[model samples]
Target chain A: MTIGEVRENPAPAASVVRQPTFVVEPSKGWLALNLQEVWEYRELLYFLAWRDIKVRYKQTILGAAWAIIQPFFTMVIFSLFFGRLAKIPSDGIPYPIFSYAALVPWTFFANGLTQSSNSLVASANLIKKVYFPRLVVPISSILSGAVDFVLAFIVLLVMMVYFDTLPTWNIVWLPLLLLLALVTSLGVGLWFTAMNVQFRDVRYAVPFLVQAWMFATPIAYPSSLLGEPWRTLYGINPMVGVIEGFRWALLGVNTAPGPVIIISSLVSVGLLVSGAFYFRRMEKTFADVV
Target chain B: MSDVAIRVQNLSKQYHIGGTQAGYKTLRESLVEGIQAPFRRARKLLRGQATGAAELDETIWALKDVSFEVNEGEVVGIIGRNGAGKSTLLKVLSRITEPTRGRAEVYGRVGSLLEVGTGFHQELTGRENIYLNGAILGMKKAEIERKFDEIVAFAEIEKFIDTPVKHYSSGMYVRLAFAVAAHLEPEILLVDEVLAVGDVAFQKKCLGKMGDVAKSGRTVLLVSHNMGAIDALCETTVFLEQGKVVDIGQTPVVIQQYLSSLYDIADYSLQNRVDRGGSGRAKINYIYLATSDGLPLQQVLSGQEVMIVIGYESQIPLNHPTFKLTVYNNVGQPLTQFDSSLTNALFIQLPLRGYVGCQLGKLPLSARRYRLHASLDNGVELLDHWTGAYSFTVGPGNYYGTGRNVVGLKDVCLVDQTWQLLENAPEVHWSV
Candidate 1:
């Protein structure tokens, strides 16, 4: 080919004049989120979530089995420590089954809390190197914990069957509770993840927070034991509602958990929106700081 | 009314140059600043503020007053030296960082391959990373599954696809990462210099894949130091210096312009003052390359007397912290190396901050340029190093050497070299 011929193209491809379109502006306000943009990058979200799952299961002799083992072992320890030794109340359900049910969602929440908080910092290489919706990192981290949730749920189901206590009609309420759990986890995860990007101390503070949080929640005991007003106020800890609801729905526990569920759901959703805005506000500095 | 696929106008991104420690301003200080912000902004908007005189503790604009446009399907290359703001521009364009001033508008789905294999888990197998990377690039799970075999084949890593990426050589990781990114099929693709990771063959494949994407009527922005690749693939090029667009024009013209101007920058003085310190026993004060007369020469001709000057300071002088210099060929293969302390020049109880200037006469280095890899070591302990002293060219000269045949020879000999000679055989006189 002649040099000129090499320079001349066979065809004019897509000849559209490039013009400047949108300028990225820093999000204003204390907590402002453009969720639409994140929503648009949903494909990236799915892949990151999938990648987390595959990596977690990749080379081990027991692949997805590790997901079940973590929560299963934690449940065993909790049952032994609080159930047998402390003689904590379980709302009349078998201690193992009761704690395991609550542990399923709590494990999901705790894992999501730790992973998502560190997500922006941990993916510093990727964040610095590529551009996508920064929220995808932490959200995927939270979603990745879903694998453990599913695996542990199976164990929960087996435990329920072994105890010969089938879930009541209230079991249909399970999806809402699961969504509630996700919101609560994501909300808290977003705040910590954003904070962790700016202050690395957040990473150190997260595990200790999770440990303290497990004690604060009634995973070992019943929220009902707290009595009136305090019991109603106890729902301010959103997980109280989730754990109580899990027991009520699965074991047919008589404590209606009434206004507690309503209050917790509102609180969880509020945390999610607030956390998302906080994350978005802080996200502008992530590439620079991280 | 030209069709502009990407448009940037008056764009600027400012960054505080110091550590995050600067982030901690007292609450009272913040309150005072918060009260003043609105009035300051209003006054600036009403009348343009002048005299940016107080430059200390000031924000450095990574990209300032940058404006450009790229039509659909236009493949553009961004070229610049280190810290010249190529990455910053890409970050702003890709929406990684919001520009502090001005605006940039991008139409269509933008996918950035800033660092390939980003999100690859070391504990995960190559197969998993591919899917993960593909997803990060915005491909659907179903889409990746369908192209799974093709990606694996293109990476030429089918045998170890199931092996964790940590076990794969960096080359394999890069190949697999590029394959996933190439197949992502975003409307607009922004690539950084991460392609430097792969082997030559894989890089060629990556270039081909990028070319195919551009040909299929997709917009691409490529940033690479490889002039050959830029010349071959990019239709147009943009040159950025200190975060601003210096030139934007046709490919070969802009690249040639950039290469020439690179030589024009005479910041060789930075190499004159050297600071080497990092858990080291001996410290190097000055490192330089000088001509026969001990005059520092920025450029060198072949067969010249090139002296290596090394000044150092020792603390509790030991047997090592051996001052060494190694010259590597263009492809990073060590050519001719010299270590002073190994040759019994080890100075014991050396005066603190002493000078050790070694003059090697009649430097036999050929026309090709080489990097001086100077380091100090105590046996296996690496005390300090000047990773780079400036590189100077060696011009062809009248040296009576037959091995000069390898001077301009490119490719294999330039990398793996050997010397051979013609000798007279007593029995075989086969020449006509």
Candidate 2:
């Protein structure tokens, strides 16, 4: 009955400790996105990502080869439909290399979005049972996609060699383009992930969203077909810049990336910031609702 | 340098109750509610009412104004009945869920074992899962690496470490998971009923490890229904009832208080108790404890005559109805059951409404609080089943007439026994 009267004392022993104290309470105002806490849990993030990568390829016949096969097959299908059937222009580059280049980052973005959006629900066990930065779940899912992207990138290089269309020095911009793709995926993925926790309809909607988004991006076709303002507006879908930038950089395509890249970069960063805030807002409710 | 490993002040968690749907609302329910919101508001406005029964505020506080402080190197036990918010308190302190009001501050690296192997992937190998589960429990990779060999050796699964966990037997899987958790080495540990799994030896090992952890000057908060473990391990105990702390003191005193409270409910009316389940063709009305001579009894001594009177009603006539009365110990483990059908008393006709009494010549249970669960069923169909329908206390008595009392006995039951010794005949039995 006198539990409240218990006096606090200094910890005994002379060992130096680095643990930080924390206060848990209901959200009162705009919560800070404690990036420091997430940084401290960075090792957990690495293990989680490693687990996802290992589990994805476990008990499989093709193993990591499946990563390459997914985008390669999608590229074949897009080439047949858009290039051979619809006669869609590819800015004078071979259609296979053009679409394959776009699909490399596109697959990474799509897979990252789909996986990260469901990451919280999928790891509901850990979310409810243990305390960790919930952001680790979605971030690890996105990070795992980087492995798939790297594997598919090697195949993209092979395709470029086969098509006899090598890249110019523009390929130096590939890492920046990959980073943009990552940011864009994580931003939108965070929003969908948080929403998925409340309404599971987001889970079923993600695949359709990815499919619709792929069409909206200029994967099978060139963005050059659109005019100036429309092309600029098309960059509202951040993958437009990523895919266009990939084509421009990898295949030495003539697609102008100046205004669209700026618009898409701004959009990607904007989505990242806003989505992170929204995700953090819903973060406290996740353990209860999930 | 704060010695208070955990401090909770006025911490509470509110959960909505009494609705057609509860907790997580599915999309369909939300959609329907969304569509009907305007009409519901209009009706409320017309009635000059500000709220409805289905409003979100129709809530029950699982933990209300609870305040507790755990000092360094203290192993505190939280003892309470089911739904007493013991788990909720641990969950709040562990930061798995945010408290609805007030705050809880933990001054150390808190490792919570709310469940063992929480994030273990069945498809991953045992070695891989160790790293994964350790990380999920907030252990750094280097920490896990340092303890990897120790964990594997402790689990005794070194031979099968490379095999996927899904292929391991249930026991092996649990051992590996528990080994990783045991090596977490957090400054504060919060465990909730995780010892209920695994075999007896493994549980003993876990308890020993927990004891060592406590002795190493780290704080531990354990929530368990096992009075034996609580009495053995905890220096202090907190008893909760209906979201409020009823007692907080030495372990033996609090546990005794908890046990005594169980005997306070002499008669339980089963009519409106919503925790019952079954087809509802027949429903239990009321249950009471009595003596063999039909005298109402509240508490009886062990090995004394006792009877359980069950009043029930059936919508239709039941033939050869089986009535089962199961008794469980204080920790929710079923001690024994008495089934009418199991005996030779079969093919008995039952009226639409009547009272059925099960008379025991001598209650073989030891001195402890026990729960009664009753069910009325036909051979073909279940009519009604009430869990925790009633609870009673069995005080100690000299069942064998040995002039010795078994009050405060820890064993579950008492058995009659006799021993005889042959005088002066066993001196030459040592031939090799």
Candidate 3:
């Protein structure tokens, strides 16, 4: 959305007082998202992410072990219900590795979305007193979830080795795919968190939404069942592209995800851009009613 | 002009009166309204109604047409009674909340101490909280690192720096919190009434730091109920009344004008004063001067027999309730106190809702206006701690029963004593 001006200025103005470092009023119209302020406070982003990671693990007997435990057990349940019982097609790869691969990124997206969606309300204390980019709250909440993603990824790699599936040169596409997952997570997070500020019912609705979203993605079954045009049409749900791309990158799957990636990428970028603008619109009113 | 650090133009903030429910409506109410909106409109049309009944939400202007400017390196004081929009103005300037009308242009980096320890984590160590709290207050990482040792020394918590802040005593927590705030260096600083809390020594240390900040030539916009601090540090003071800017000028004159207005607020019944504290076991209904024969008097005279009666209402009987009445001059300085417990004054079981009076042999002060702070403690808990419960002026009179009037300028109160002057020099060698 910020193809225009994107700064709430960090002017080093020694001479121009009238130019003013900032002008405070009830923001009118569609203003820039002030991403420049977000960049200036990057260290706060790190500290907040660090705080979340540290505090979540503290005083728990399992600690970061829960990070691996959560996705692994969920994968086991999927392999049982979808793979063994339902005879769900998995593109000829082992279903455990198949589900585990998707679970790594899927867990990251789901937890990140849930945490970031609730982040603003949980940080009401900081919001009411201080002035900072409210964007930092949801972003840092997402960043903290990446730690668990990495830990879970290590387990997925170990599972991959056991299953004898290897990666190809397509692995280079992994970073963009992970980024797409994050953008999608943050996009939906911004919308829902902003809405949660207005309507607390969003909090109760999130887990249900996440559960439905996971099933909508191709985690339990391959997208190949729906033939050709419909198969590609299914990529309207963005995570389909992410999960399929991950499979193509790691397992050297024959289907290259052609139109699915294109459609999904377009949809995701749209979600992010619009989500940012909507978030900026709601940002001014947060402290007043938070 | 470049020298103008802050220019506020008719800045205002309006809040809905029953705002918590009105502004933050539950999703069910919103959903129901959304679904029923067309029907409601149709029903209104059928009834031939022209008014918009749904738009009947109440609102209040916390700040209205508030405009002021602070020159570069000037310390400006904001003074007002409770709910006078003082804190709202500071919040708007600090950008914590946006103004609904107009705007303010702040020239430099803003640091606000609206409340100390703004984002301190209780689970974190004192050391971690300093860095985290500093960062939240807009200090950079290196800035906090450079001042790390200084902050620790300032808080005097070197030994407990690594311990979790949750374990700290309340006093230590406040000290550490103020320490981080004291170290924040911004181009413009907006300080709220942070000095009102903390112990005597802590308040002095905080005041000393505030004075240092004022002398450092940075622009400062300060809001405080402490007139003494406002007068000591600020060159010009802005007086606010009922959400509007009432006066702004040289500090002394504005403070005098603000204090004079305190007398106007005294006429309101304490039942609705709103500015009071303590547990709600009992409430001070009103307080006024009374003649010895128990008729109410508007004012008293020095060297005259006077009685002050306190009216109160309580849910339960006050058990031998100890009462304290403190007198403060118009400048908010405590002048004298009459405490019942200290004097061993006896009382039977006090009625739940009734009057109690303390008789004075002679009015102790002369020729000045004074306010009263009356408090009741029912032995178990404080029932009321009402400041400025009443105010009256004493006419010039001979406090010592002398032929001349007592001058109140040199002291707060006058005491009686006979002076023989020891004309013989007392050289009778009683010590030897």
Pick by lDDT: 1 or 3, better one: 3
Candidate 3 TM-score, C-alpha based: 0.74
Q: List the pairs of residues colliding in candidate 2.
A: none
Q: What is the lDDT of residue B174 in candidate 1?
A: 81
Residues B1-432, model 3: lDDT tens digits: 327788787888987655333453789988988888667755643332321322346678899987777778889999887899998898888887878898888889999989988888888899988988988888999999999999999888999999999999998899999999999999999998887557767787888999999999988888887665776789899999888988888886776566546544544443245467779779876666766544445457778788887767788878888889999887998878988887757765887766677889989887788878989887889889987777788877778876787766766677888888676685675685
Worst 10 residues of 1 chain B by lDDT: B46-55
Clashing pairs in 3: none
- Shift of residue B24 alpha carbon in model 1, Å: 14
Looking at model 2 chain A, report the run of 10 residues with the lowest lDDT sum: A7-16
Q: DockQ of each model against the real complex?
A: 0.28, 0.49, 0.34
Predicted model with the maximum DockQ: 2
Evaluating just chain A, the predictions reach TM-scores of 0.89, 0.93, 0.93
lDDT of 1 at B352: 59
Model 2 over residues B1-432: C-alpha lDDT tens digits?
Answer: 335667788888886664553553789988887889768765643333323333655678899989988777788999887899998888888888888898887887889999888999999999999989998898888888999999999888999999999999999999999999889888889998876557768877887777787678778899887665676678899999888888898986786566546457343333235477788898876566665533345468887888777767799778889999999988999889999888776737888866677888888888888888889898778988888777777788876677787785567898888888878676786789
- Model 2, A75: alpha-carbon shift in Å? 1.4
